[model samples]
Target: MSDILKGLEPERVFRYFEEICAIPHGSGNEKAISDYCVAFAKSHNLWFRQDEANNVIIRKPASEGYEDAPIVMLQGHMDMVCEKNSDVDFDFEKEGLKLRIVDDMIYASGTTLGGDDGIAVAYALAILEDDHLAHPELEVVITTDEEVGMDGARALDVSDLKAKYLLNLDNEEEGQILTSCAGGMKSRAAIPTRHVEWEGVSAVIRISGLKGGHSGAEIHCGRANANRLLGRVLMNLNKELNVGVREVNGGMKDNAIPREAEAKIVLDPEDIQRAMEIKNEFVAAIADEFAVSDPDIRIELNVECNENRQHTIIHPADMERALFVFIQSINGIQTMSMELPGLVESSLNLGIVRTEEDNVNFAWAIRSSKKSLKYLMSDQLQYLAEFVGGTYWYEGEYPHWSFKSDSKLREVVASSYRDLFGKEARIEAIHAGLECGLISEKMPDLDIVAIGPDIHDIHTPGEHLSIPSVERSYRLICDVLSRLKA
Candidate 1:
């Protein structure tokens, strides 16, 4: 707790947010938080249920005079992405998030703050307790494992819910309503590695200091992918000199852009200086290429002899094929939206690459508003993998929510926002994957609109929430509920 957010109007919301921070509720480990919500409902004497998938739904009767209004569902995920700084010692599964207030923002120390969806959960809890606010039938649906997959939302029995309209509290920006989002699928390739004896010096090539971000949300920003850059360096080295790769690894999460990558290779002693020269040239080219997005790119090389080397290096032919395929893989925004100017409609991210004892694995994720485009991208990746003598696989495919131009609830929300703020509000769509896509599949006719307070750097260590924006956003939500009852 800091002085910056001490005097906020939504004291109850902040209080619950703080309480949730103290709990370790990472994406897959959400049982504790789910139980906590259920207990809170029982203590407050509100009707609630814990479904088979651990999704919680709390039902509250309408205010005295608003009983005739249609029911509205306040939706948000209960789980948060488990991400931390590379040097942070805190374990996401055991340790609570350490929150700090800096100026007008609230953030966690060396870890994600979970403000992406936690604020929505807190707001819904506070609203349920506030007897003064005017609203119709309220149903708070808190689902689990939304960060990894929309398992809870997908498993939900829509027939059990009475709400016809849903307000998803998962959007990152305030003053904007997200009407649609892209569908996505994970693509992976496996390349078998064969080791061969090497009689050459060993060196480590490392790439670091790149500004990485969310592959989906920040792809349109034109940030550099470290894995791809590293592959470029390897391809150049193989072309100019004789090198045998012993190990290569980079990046962790599939959803996040890679910041650093390193490779260990055995090469002739005479090629060490030439490799360093090429590394410098590659660094300069990358800096100029990603000047606007990643200006701090760095590449370095270290020469050292192996003292206890027991294994052989990968064959030169195999290394060349793998490096070439990796460098040729297209990453980032591939197509722009025709319907919305400057919006990315289809994109791909080369998320992770690793070398194990006998195989090399490459992981990628593709997101698109159009199903045909997604399949096209997948086919391209599979072709690349097959051309390089590897096998491709797909996982975690989810549907996209197509935009509905004549949504009744969208009209109501737009008019309500204009009346409250005395101006027009932006109704837009995002390229990132959202749980609404899966929820919509279950409830075809349910009207959905996602909104939230201003939050930045979600799914990363620098995540934070804007206090002022949150206060205003909460008030606006209440106004929307009031207008709905009228």
Candidate 2:
């Protein structure tokens, strides 16, 4: 347990958060964490179910005289996006996050601080453990594999849940209530590769310093993806200096904007100077192009050449196709919502590119609030990949949670927030994917509203949760629960 959270108000929330951080609950690796939740439920004498997908639903009866009140469901995913700096050697499957508190903000040393949804689990646990809090019958649903996709939510049997009002504690902002979210799918393409031996100079071109962030939330910000930028550099070098690529690798998760990418290439010794010149020009052009969105963007080259050294290079035709996939792939917001000014309606992020042993893989995270638009984007990607000598497929498809014209759950949450803070809370739709969409499909009559404390840089190493906001939000949720009626 981290003593950093000692003496924090709403003590159990922080304590449970630290406890969760001590477990490696990354996406696709939540069995241990799921058992932990079951154990917690058993110790408290609560009814619980652990499904095959590792989703856990614990039932807590209403307190004192609140049994007849409407059943209010608290929902959040148990899995967290596992991302870390390149130099960090932490394993997402086994090792726990090295948590630290600085100036009341909690973060991991060199890895993502899974505060995005972990805090939600912590909040639910704290509320469930407390014997004095007033609330309706509670169905605390802790889901799994939400970062990669809403796998748990998709596989969950919500038929057992009788809760009509659901409070999703998964939003990032403290004062904003998100009632709707964009649908999303992960698209992947595999390009064929043929290796050949060639003697020449070998050098690495790296693009770094881009302010990468969440693909869905920050895609409209014009951040330069390191994978895309590297593609541009390789294309320019091939055109200007006739370079041959050995391998290209960058980006971690499909949901995160790549901050850095590296391409290893082989070229004639004579073209080294020309490649350097083109690299500088491209870097300058990119910096100028994304000056507002990625001011700190940088490009570097590290060279090691030997006249007699032979290196393996991907076949020229295959290399061109791979480069085209990286360069021509559409990224960022594709369309804006006309009805809601300043809202993104459709977008895609070319989030990951890697050179495999026999092929190069490219992946994009596509999102749209409209189902048709989402399918259209996926179709475009499929065509692009098949147009070349590659194959494309989609996975983790989740539905869009459209904004409701009238939601009593939203009304209750907003009114409760205003009553507590003396100010109106913002109601809006988010571009990111949430489990609420799938859950709504399972239980169409469920009225859902999402809220959470302040968390910044989610899905990245800079991710941190605000301690003060957590405490404040804890109080707000308790107040909201007290205010709910049948």
**TM-score per model over all chains:** 0.93, 0.98
Clashing pairs in 2: none
Residue pairs whose backbone atoms clash in candidate 1: none
Question: Please, what are the lDDT tens digits per residue for candidate 1 over residues 302-400?
Answer: 887844344388877787777867888878898999989988999998878999887788988789999999999999989999998999989878899
The regions of model 1 sitting more than 4 angstroms off are: 1-7, 304-311
Single out the weakest 10-residue window by summed lDDT for candidate 2: 301-310
Backbone Cα, N, C clashes tallied per candidate: 0, 0
Model 2 deviation from the true structure expressed as Cα RMSD, one decimal place: 1.1
